[model samples]
Target: MIKIFTTIFLLIIGSTGFAIADTDYQLHAELIAKNTYVFIGKKEDFSMVNGGNILNTAFIVTNEGVVLIDSGPSYQYALQAKAAINEITDKPVIKIFITHSHPDHFLGNQVFPDASIYALPTTIRELKTNAESFLDNVYRLADYWMAGTEVSINSILPLNSTSELIGEHSLRYLFLKGHTAADLAILDETTGVLFTGDLVFHNRAATTPHANIEAWLLSLDKLEQIRFNLLVPGHGEVTGNISPIKQTREYLTWLDVTIKRSVMDGLSMNEVINLPVPEQFQNLAVLKSEFMRSVIHRYPIYEKTLFEQIE
Candidate 1:
């Protein structure tokens, strides 16, 4: 613990003794487990302050090369992430996995274009269909940080039907639509580490522009059945325990119930936004902002469903 803290302290305080090349760099990697490292992004919302580096990316060093979980939010951020990985090992990144169709998760493909990029076929379809509008919106939200970032994933090979073996490691890919149309969770059978894309977000309010709440909830149950030694989320800290899964489940359940009740009560969007969150979720970063966005995206569906049921 002390060693990890010391390294972070030096990087943060810009200690001249440390080997960090740029003192102003935004992301940092934490050694989470044997042969595994995670670059946890900011828990805050998209902003110039964070440069939209608010999505977690990780890499595992293997005998053949490195396997990157997700590129960061943009081209520049991915470059920074790769540089950080390079500081430790010169092994080239052999593979890239897009956990979902969200812009933040896949736009960084431009930075790591050398590797074979893979995503669920459904994810590829969504990106192909919505990439234009999504990129436009992401450019506005992330602004300067995404200045040069364009959708570079021309063809994301379908990651289906089997595990890809690299060296002695077997990467078991699971298709989950909990967080988006397609959320990919990779389990490193060698290390028992599960890279759970955005299917699980800890210590932060989850964004749900493309989420099916019911499907996402069932996905959490699937997570409970999986065996993993360490869990790395698309945002927040890595954990050795399943507490993060519990956190995600509770938050989603509360959000679903609250939104459904608000719809039944005929609450306006603003009223739903103002509704108090459970105390357990009050401290999460960007809680209100994300919750408001989620309401805007999902509440109308509930309203329509209730209207049809009444009819």
Candidate 2:
């Protein structure tokens, strides 16, 4: 009796640990329409781990198969994503669309080995050139939060055209080069869903590390011309109206104006970093303390001006 009780106790403890591990990487699937669904990942805060807060992954699926927009950071995430899709449909994932070369968006490419991977030429170049350092950084800062997984890099499909048809839907790929050289925006004409990647952040603050502030503003203008009822961002919740896109544009505009004024006044990057957001923007949900730091890090106006001076 003692032996049996001990064995049962061990099994219960093991099961409990497994359950906790599963919850650590929470995955949620929401049906957006009749045949389409979005998979959102809930993982530990990546920015705070190395860079701010927790992160998630979003993808669109259909009956024919899945056309993934972005892959999450870990192989485990990919596996979980695969499982989530399988739960809804048994068809194979036919194509994978990578919005950019960011690890949070493309590291899970290994999971869809048979699918044709699509990306911008510049995106492919950055992944090839900096993948090593990117992985190193993830391991260095977010290893504990990564769920012990690795992904292999392979070939990627290039897109120089404006649009491509995936399944029964037509996805228009627009080149908006600000956040990254090859940031692609997908517009589904049928569903009126625009997968804007990082081009437009609804409530969240937009990062501009590899961004061109002037070019970004122009891209925003172009996006305004296009019609999209649903805007799916790289981070944050989905938006139904054009207000988020407009808000993102306004934020960038404000940043540009503020930075330019500071530059004219000869204010230092450190000074700009210490500066706070205006009282007007403080009411916005995504413009919290966490995003303020990201904005400062990404598009440090003083840093750019200093670099220009050095050059």
Q: What are the lDDT scores of the predictions, listed in order? A: 0.83, 0.69
- Minimum summed lDDT over a 10-residue window in model 1 is located at 17-26
Residues 179-247 of candidate 2: C-alpha lDDT, one tens digit per residue:
778788888886888887777775666666677767877877888888877777666667777776787
List TM-score per model, in order.
0.89, 0.82
Model 2 vs. true fold: TM = 0.82
- Candidate 1 lDDT by residue in tens digits, 116-136: 898889888998999778777
Q: Alpha-carbon error at 182 in model 1, in Å? A: 1.0
Superposed Cα deviation of residue 18, candidate 1 (Å): 31
